[model samples]
Target: MSTTFEEITRPDNGPLVELNNNMQEVFSQYRKMREYASYLEYELKQKDEHILKVENENSFLRDKHTTFDSNGKSVEPIIT
Candidate 1:
């Protein structure tokens, strides 16, 4: 005689089989959400580093431009 899948896995009761299937589905969805959260965190770190590099370059160029006047006289420092 051949036995069906449900009969072999859950011969005791019908409700128990349904509960087991539901639990498996919930766990699968949780795993995918965790992976997406990790990807977003990595992207945020890269953007922060790029912003700092641009700010440093702007400061360096401003200093070089204002170091001397057109008549070759020293220019007074401007307070931030």
Candidate 2:
């Protein structure tokens, strides 16, 4: 005799089938979340590197344009 899907997944086996389906869904969702987390981590790292680069450029520009007075004192730029 050949066994059909309906016969194998009858009411008697309904709970086991449901449990397997639920587990598969949970695992699928977990994998997706892990992938998203990895992408977010990569984006954060890139942003941090860009921020550092900008800060270093700003520091270099500030040092390059710094002015000193005859009294050996640093002079602040007038914002007027």
Candidate 3:
């Protein structure tokens, strides 16, 4: 639901109109902050997914090019 400025300032509410406007301003700010928070949450989720994908790819490549010697040390494969 939305309210126009004229409607919000209507004469019917009399003494309470001033208070009503203040409350409305506070609510408007709250709504904006909530929207920003939601956007940040979405971006964070996307970044986390990307990081996980990159980590997995790196692990796969590393294993493919690496070998374990009998001494329990990592031996990188040579591509002559």
Candidate 4:
């Protein structure tokens, strides 16, 4: 009379519910980290592209500014 039907026969499912909730929280945090990592990857690629463009421009300017001697040696650059 004192024991309920659920308490006597049904196994306790509270722990299972708690475990499932914890798994959901972990997956949510994992997704956020993955998104942040992808954003950082995009930023890094943009930075690399900017660096390549700058280097190419610098090379072009250097070739335009410098003078070569007849002995295949570089002379002092005369920057206008």
TM-score, per-candidate, Cα-based: 0.56, 0.71, 0.74, 0.79
Q: How big is the positional error of residue 63 in model 4, measured in Å on the Cα after superposition?
A: 0.6
Which digits, one per residue and each the tens of the lDDT, describe model 2 over residues 20-74?
9999999999999999999999999999999999999999998777888999777
- lDDT scores for all predictions? 0.82, 0.91, 0.91, 0.94
Prediction 4 global C-alpha lDDT: 0.94
Pitting candidate 1 against candidate 3, the one with the higher TM-score is: 3
- Candidate 1 lDDT, tens digit per residue, 1-80? 99666544636766888898988888888888888888888888888888888888898877776778799786987889
> Which portions of model 2 miss their true places by more than 4 Å?
1-11, 69-73, 77-80
Q: What residue runs in model 4 are displaced by over 4 Å at the alpha carbon?
A: 1-8, 78-80
Candidate 1 lDDT at 7 equals 44
Superposed Cα deviation of residue 49, candidate 1 (Å): 1.1
Cα distance off (Å), candidate 4, residue 44: 0.7
**Candidate 2 pairs with clashing backbones:** none
Better of 1 and 2 by TM-score: 2
Deviation in angstroms for 56 in model 3?
Answer: 0.5
Ranked by TM-score, the better of candidates 1 and 4 is 4
TM-score, predicted candidate 3 vs. hidden true structure? 0.74
lDDT of 3 at 42: 100
**Candidate 3, position 65, lDDT:** 81
